[model samples]
Target chain A: DVKVTQSSRYLVKRTGEKVFLECVQDMDHENMFWYRQDPGLGLRLIYFSYDVKMKEKGDIPEGYSVSREKKERFSLILESASTNQTSMYLCATDPGDSRYEQYFGPGTRLTVT
Target chain B: AQSVTQPDIHITVSEGASLELRCNYSYGATPYLFWYVQSPGQGLQLLLKYFSGDTLVQGIKGFEAEFKRSQSSFNLRKPSVHWSDAAEYFCAVRGYQKVTFGTGTKLQVIP
Candidate 1:
């Protein structure tokens, strides 16, 4: 079974605080992705990594950055959290071997107060 | 940029009734389409995908989708919907380097 785990299910942070969301995939997939799900906007990709230490920005990467030092672990960083950044964050993994299917984690709901 | 659209925001169907959810997309070339279901507070689960070949694709939980190239639509259908089938359904299309998803359609199955 392909399992993707996230660091937190729910998080609360004050404005201007730095927050980090961690994700780990057990399937050893080469491609990892971070997306934010909003009410009407659907899932907007924040960033994705094709390989270790290589990351690419997605549709909405303005307030976030990503790190993938190791193959199994990918981290999403909020340089300075803001109220507008509060949303449900999801992490996903693709086999990168032409499978074209992505497995997703439960998701992390972040609240900026 | 390429995009996807789910015409209906929500659809309610009785248990054992047939259901169909509409999805349309605008892609330059041959499109890779996918249908995913997400339960509340959970991640998205792949229902089915259409890359090429057959137009009708069968998926898990007795769900199926038909791809129509002329209409630019891939609509999901189920002969009999169960109460547990209530969830959010998202249609996606692979465009450029990433996959673009629709706003999603919330399915409500009534007993």
Candidate 2:
């Protein structure tokens, strides 16, 4: 079975706090993605990495960054957490084929105060 | 450029009634289409996907979606709805390299 796990299922951070969200996949996939879900905005891509040490910005990458030091692990970092950044963050991994579907983690609900 | 759209922000259906969620996309050619369901606090689950071959595709939870190239749409449908089916559904399209997601449609199944 394919499994994707996140470091935290729920998180709370104060303003100006540095937040780190970790994601790990056992599928050995080369592509990983990070997205945030809001009330009506749906899932907006934050960042994605094709392979280790490679990253690409998505439509909404402001105030967010990503790290892919290892093939199975991808991390999303927030330099400074804000109230507006409070949302459900999801991590996903692709099977390296554009025609294939992506596997997702349980997601982290972050509350920034 | 490639984009996906889900016209309905919210939909309500009875537990035993039929359900349909609409999705549309715009691209040079038919892109890889997918439908995902997100529970209240869970990750997005892939309902179904359509790349080529058959236009109608069946998915988990007895859900299905049809691909209409002429209409540029891939609408998800289910013959009967269940209370457990109340969740947010997202439509996604993958182009050459990256995947683009629609705003999403929220489904509310009533008992």
Candidate 3:
């Protein structure tokens, strides 16, 4: 079975503090994505990585950035966390096959005070 | 531009009652449709997908969705709803490398 794991399940940080959310997938997939979930707004993509050291901004990438240093791990970084950035963060990976199905991680809920 | 819509924001159904969740999409060409379920504090789980033929696609947890090209809709249905089925359901559409998700419908199962 394919599994995606996030470093933290819940996190609380002060506003302006730097935050790091880590995601690792064991499926050896080529594509990884970061999304933030908010009530009523649903899931909005923050960033995505198609290969190691390659990243692209998604729909709502304003206050977020990403790094893909290795094939199995992708990291989401918040240069300066803010209250508005509080959200449930999700990580997903696509198997690169034409199907384009994404497997997701358990999610990290971040609360910026 | 491709987009996905889940008109109903929230749905409430009694346990064991039949349920249907609507999803509509707008894409230029053939789309890859998917239905995912997210429990509280958990990630989204793939419930079903529709890529091509066989309009009616069966999924895990006794859930099924049908793709209708004429209607541009892929609606999910279940014969019976369980309390555990109460969660946020998302419908997504893939075009090339990008996937667009619906706003999501939060299901509430009444005992």
Candidate 4:
């Protein structure tokens, strides 16, 4: 079965702490995306990669960086976790669909204090 | 820029009751739309999508969505909702390069 897995379901970190959220997709999709979901803002794209070691910033990429060293994995990095950075992070991969239908991970809810 | 909108913030329905969640979008060209369900803390699961062809699209978990280009809407529907259907539903539209999602509508199914 096609699958997208995240490193954590829930995490808590203090302000100024660096954080890493990992996403791995079993399907060898060409494009990967990172999104931040807020209470009323839906999901905002943070970063996306069409290939390994290549990345593009999305609507909200500030305070967040992404790395894609492997075709199967993508990582989101927070330079310093702040209270405003607390949100649910979602990772998705496109199965090369022309319309860009995405497969998503379970998501990681990060809490910064 | 293209965008999607879900007007309802929340809706509650009884088990076995019919359900409909409204979604609308704004795009210059033929829009690619999607409906996704998020269960509690889990990620969003694709319920259905509409690119072209039939305006009415069937999806997983007995869900369906209809695309109305005239109205710029893609509304999700179910004949009968189950208790397990309680979740947040999001409508999305694929713009030129990226997909923009609506804030979402939270569904609550009660017995």
Which 10-residue span in candidate 4 chain B carries the lowest summed lDDT?
B92-101
Off by over 4 Å in 3: A98-100
Q: Model 3, A1-112: lDDT tens per residue?
A: 9999999999999999989999999989999999998899888989998899999999999988898999999999999999999889999999876476799999998999
In angstroms, how far off is B108's CA in candidate 4? 0.7
How good is the docking of model 2, as DockQ?
A: 0.84
List CA RMSD, all candidates: 1.0, 1.0, 1.0, 1.2
DockQ for every model, please: 0.62, 0.84, 0.77, 0.74
Tens-digit lDDT string for candidate 4 (B59-99): 99999999998999899999999999999999999865578
lDDT of 1 by residue, B13-105 (tens): 999999999999999999989999999989999999999999999999999999999999999999999999999999999864577889999
- What DockQ number belongs to candidate 3? 0.77
Q: For this target, which candidate reaches the highest DockQ against the unseen true structure? A: 2
Give lDDT for model 2: 0.93
Candidate 3 root-mean-square deviation in Å: 1.0
Which pairs of residues clash in candidate 2, taking residues 3 or more apart in a chain or in different chains?
none
What docking grade applies to model 2? high
Off by over 4 Å in 4: none
Q: Candidate 1 chain B: minimum summed lDDT over ten consecutive residues — where?
A: B92-101
- The digit string of per-residue lDDT tens for model 3 on B11-45 reads 99999999999999999999899999999878999
